[model samples]
Target: MRLSLTPLGVLLGAIFSTAVLAQDSDTTTITDYDVISAPALSSDRIKSEVLIEVTTVGTRLIAVGAHGNIIWKEGDDWQQAEVDTSVLLTSIAFADEQNGWATGHHGVIIKSEDGGKSWKRQLDGFELMTLEEGYFENRIEKLNEQLESTDDEDVIGELEWQLEEAQFQVSNIEAAREEGPSKPFLDLYVKDSQTVLAIGAYGTFLKTEDGGESWQVISGRLENPGGYHLNTIFGRGDDLYIVGEAGLAFASYDGGENWETLDSPYRGSLFGGHLDAEGRVWVYGLRGNAFVSDDKGQNFTTVDTGTRVNLSAGTNTNKGTQLIVGHSGTILEIDDQLEVKNRTHPSGSVMTDIIEVAEGEWIMTGRSGLLHWPAKITEEEALATQQGAQ
Candidate 1:
């Protein structure tokens, strides 16, 4: 049997593995040059590059990908945006039309105040690793104190186990310090202009109350003791849901202050999730596995996608349809009744994300970069004319 790594695993391995290393100008010195500080290089071939995620800002479509490239389509053509970092961006979210943020490798979070034209680095892994180290250290100290003060045997046992976990996390933080900033944030949900939740590899969870100005490590809010990767975070109204590696699932009823674990039906990694307009929870991942929960993730039924290819991302259409894109250019359209209609593009590329441009039109990003279904866009001429009037 042939072994294959999931898309999430492949992305993480490419980021942290020692097989690929960066060298300085002389090609000899292993420079500690921070990707967060490095500016993204201008490239004319950005349209043909590997883009991971995309979103719509009003009438504009913005997409992000490798080497911190961010491109947006406003009137006629897709143009590159000014970005501060050179890190590989994995996910993008917008609080509204004007304020947006993008997350990627090295725990990077870039903010865009004017739609998606330009971005400034708001957070990075160096600061994240330091914050995580302090968090674990404090946790260890608190657990030790509790163990010393507790009288009940059951309480003592719980404190002791908590202390061990805190100590282990501290050790992992120390090791990470030596290897530079290796942590990567996979996905994020923009609740509003003031609140955002970001999650990633090794159960990394962070939140920012002041937009992207400052962030706090809040991984303790979840029940992921193994520190599994949190691949996707999404919210509908006050309910927030997170799905990750090994079928781990969590939900928060009152914002993110508290959480409860949900029983996941699939054991394989869940790459992404969707909380539909009808309040249904949909989680999809490896081998075309997908499940939907009608009662707030308490139970789930399988959603037959008809293909065995790994599903990476999904989006909600204006026509009350859900479209999921995955490897081998597979596109599965699930209606309101959970009926699936599958289609494939001729490119056969691994599509990471998709967005509906019009009623029956879509724009997708993947291994082969940006793609248009049916045709490039039948409304391009009319859209250009409208922009001219404005």
Candidate 2:
């Protein structure tokens, strides 16, 4: 008798392994009570714990998570936005106050030209994989050139064979890329009003020049044969910075054409990064790890974040650099001088994304739903409100 494993079984196995690895990497023990409960939304087919990124378009805020959960916030409440697929949604970005896009597992890409009020499926992952193959072939050509200039005949022959093999491998990759979107995008960044950059698992990086009309894969060192997972991408003018698992940080000067790795102070997953008005770089990651880089990403210094909970996302606000949302809805606010001012716990849920809308008003999204200021309230304000209510 022969036993064969189905694709579903293989996928479950992979997810299980990933969860195990995540637990193994950290010393903290995660219990059933620690897991955030999923809200009773319209759909229950997808996993509720899969939300990774969120962004806003005008008064509307779009949040994506596991199983294609596209939620939009209207006023103080959140409602599920209809989407075609149930693939895990990871990241979303807005080019303006109107046009926006969301990506997720299985090469899933959705676009909303109407400020994320509604989203329509645009492109899938298969096409992106094809573009990546094309981009990789271009790199192989350059590698072949370097091999040809070498005096070592053995090395030249070896590299030539490798190039030929790469061509064949890329052909297979092209087929896979064409297979369509599978996994949700991990993070998305708007380079400008037109260009957008997205990165994900397996070092996947894609770019769109003509808004979301067309897209091209911008390969990175992490997407190479032996690449690492990239968690987030931060854009500043013509420069782009990426941080990921194992404290991986890379900078691209000429857009995403070339990337050089920066020495990270810690060896943990980096979740978020931002450039202040003064051009200072602030990055936060797992275990409450935070770093400040004054000179682009050339050097960094670890700062006291006061908590060891994983920091998911951060942004520059008028009050200072506010890093709200992380493990267990922990909100940490850092001043311009890199001082931790306020640290409050809003909810038991894990906060996946945070964005500053106005001077004091901030919007944060997590596992359950939308987190808005003066509505759901922050930990600090909630306490004050409770005291006044009494």
Candidate 3:
């Protein structure tokens, strides 16, 4: 399969805008060598800020978003924690309650040992290029020796071509090394404290067995010959699924070591996916198109959401319903039988991730910042309003 290996943001920028689209969305990360570990600014309005992802760490909720902001739930409040990078962090995953990792623009990866309280950088684009340089240079040396012994002109030419390509790859790594780490990891799934899977644009698939200490690029394991951009990945039990651009999708039954390209239902870009409790695989994306398949993606049926806005985020909440959030403040709830229910929110920004905090309440973060959707008013709040009216 071909490997495009482009920062996901740049592709979106080309479709949206070359200038402010990436900057505003924090979507693409390029070879930027500046590694700043600045502290996040404290704010009373943090809930209204643009957060990208939220995950549960034990009983606490932790979120990461633009400007290296990491927030963890503190009792009934949310508190911002210290982070080492100002790069836009798009996804966060914890292998355990105390060990987790965050991925973002510039091929940045940070580790946290104390839940989400603090983070330390383990790998960046600079070091990644260094590793690739050594790998390609060694391969070129071996190919040169093989070329010296070959007699056939066709064989000689093939070896020479491979030698030249390997050398070219080494030079490319050196050039990108000088530029910095601009590649962005779009999503992550942590299997354990020692295992992780990260995916991104142009078939960027990586696996780490010993946490982030070492990484092995494994894009060849999937059948994505076009190097389709992989957007989101989720798993339930042993079933794993990855949804991406250009109607691309893949499923794996054994963690993520191997994959099977599943039949797609939508021809447009799919932004996110989730595996619900009922063993149903749900995928959503461009326009208002969404699909659910019970037979492990062999076939999927379209869901009528009554909106055309692109769906960006989705999760099966504690309330046993699948909630999907999208552009123009779009929200759709799916029951066990795939019945649709609509909800309203105040924010119109493109929401990236969402989770339920209460029985009927939800907290979502995205383009405009943060939004708290309350399903029902509390009795105390109603009583206070009634007293004030009198």
Candidate 4:
């Protein structure tokens, strides 16, 4: 059986959960880990470690993954930078060649000034809980005052429940602070050195304008009533897209100030999304399903990828070609003609993310550790590689 790469970060996020028992405050629970800051080990052998996200910083390529490891290719060798927090990092984004941000479990967000060399933690779940505590505490107080003057029993009941919920949240945050930060930020969007957006499971949306100096929760602007896990955020032109589990998706036109939920055709989770220069939005996820929209998601048509493996990562090449990688080392390449120009079938292991290292050569990382393939991988080459192993 081929190893599925979709678990790269998605698997880590799914396993981590904060189960808050509301009915019984004494029995409330949350996932906690004693995350410690450690120097990301630098070694040539580190390539075999699980890596989830990869991005290009000017002329350099950087990859981050499990154990808060950040590996970058400076010259011809891979080097890991010193970073705090040995948690599972889900994604990374570069605002420019000089600055970047990486996110992972425990609500960990780290930033680097010199490309991907070294990082410092800018925000964590403990701080977020502290902020939430203040917000909820204020709300609860206001609700109590409203309940005091209310004459109608109906209104009083509503306020009472609201107050209870707020109090519950405050206590939950308190418990979380004691247990350590466990909420994992799954994806990130770095607009610049000062402004950024970090999203994660359970409608966890945060924004910072002063370069993570202070973050504000903006999940209220989204219509995720069920609190679906926000999987990925992407943009092209003037539009920004957010997508995640349960076929949940939304689009923002005037920046993230306002968002409109787009109707998703698939009921399963969408792992990632990409936008082409031609205004086409491509979202791919569970079981190899991908849909493309030309009119900003008003209507969508399936891309008809001929595989059942979940697509883990999708990006546009320097030549505007689209490449998608997924479980079983499958690679789906779409050219300017909007066709599946080339495809590599399921190899032995899952390929989580793919990067074009040099023109025709590509390097991918995932559960299998690392793999090398052609930019336009084909069925013949995939089969030959599989046959050679036998």
Task: Give the winner by TM-score.
Answer: 1
Cα RMSD to the true fold for all candidates: 7.2, 8.2, 6.3, 7.3
Q: Candidate 3 at 362: error in angstroms?
A: 1.0
Estimate every model's Cα lDDT from 0 to 1.
Answer: 0.80, 0.64, 0.74, 0.73
Better of 3 and 4 by lDDT: 3
Q: Give the clashing pairs for model 4.
A: 37-85
Candidate 4 local lDDT, 224-311, one digit each (tens)? 7455678889995458899888888899997778999898978888888888768789998888898889899878888878888778
Clash count of each predicted structure:
0, 16, 8, 1
Model 3: worst 10 consecutive residues (lDDT sum): 13-22
> Using lDDT as the measure, which candidate wins?
1
76-101: candidate 3 lDDT, tens digit per residue: 87888888887777789998889999
Model 2 residue runs over 4 Å out of place are 1-51, 74-80, 137-149, 153-183, 220-225, 357-361, 372-390
Comparing 2 and 4 by TM-score, which wins? 4
| Count: clashes, candidate 3 | 8
Q: TM-score of model 2 relative to the true fold?
A: 0.74
Give the local distance difference test score of model 1: 0.80
Best first by lDDT, ranked = 1, 3, 4, 2
Model 1, position 251: C-alpha lDDT score? 93
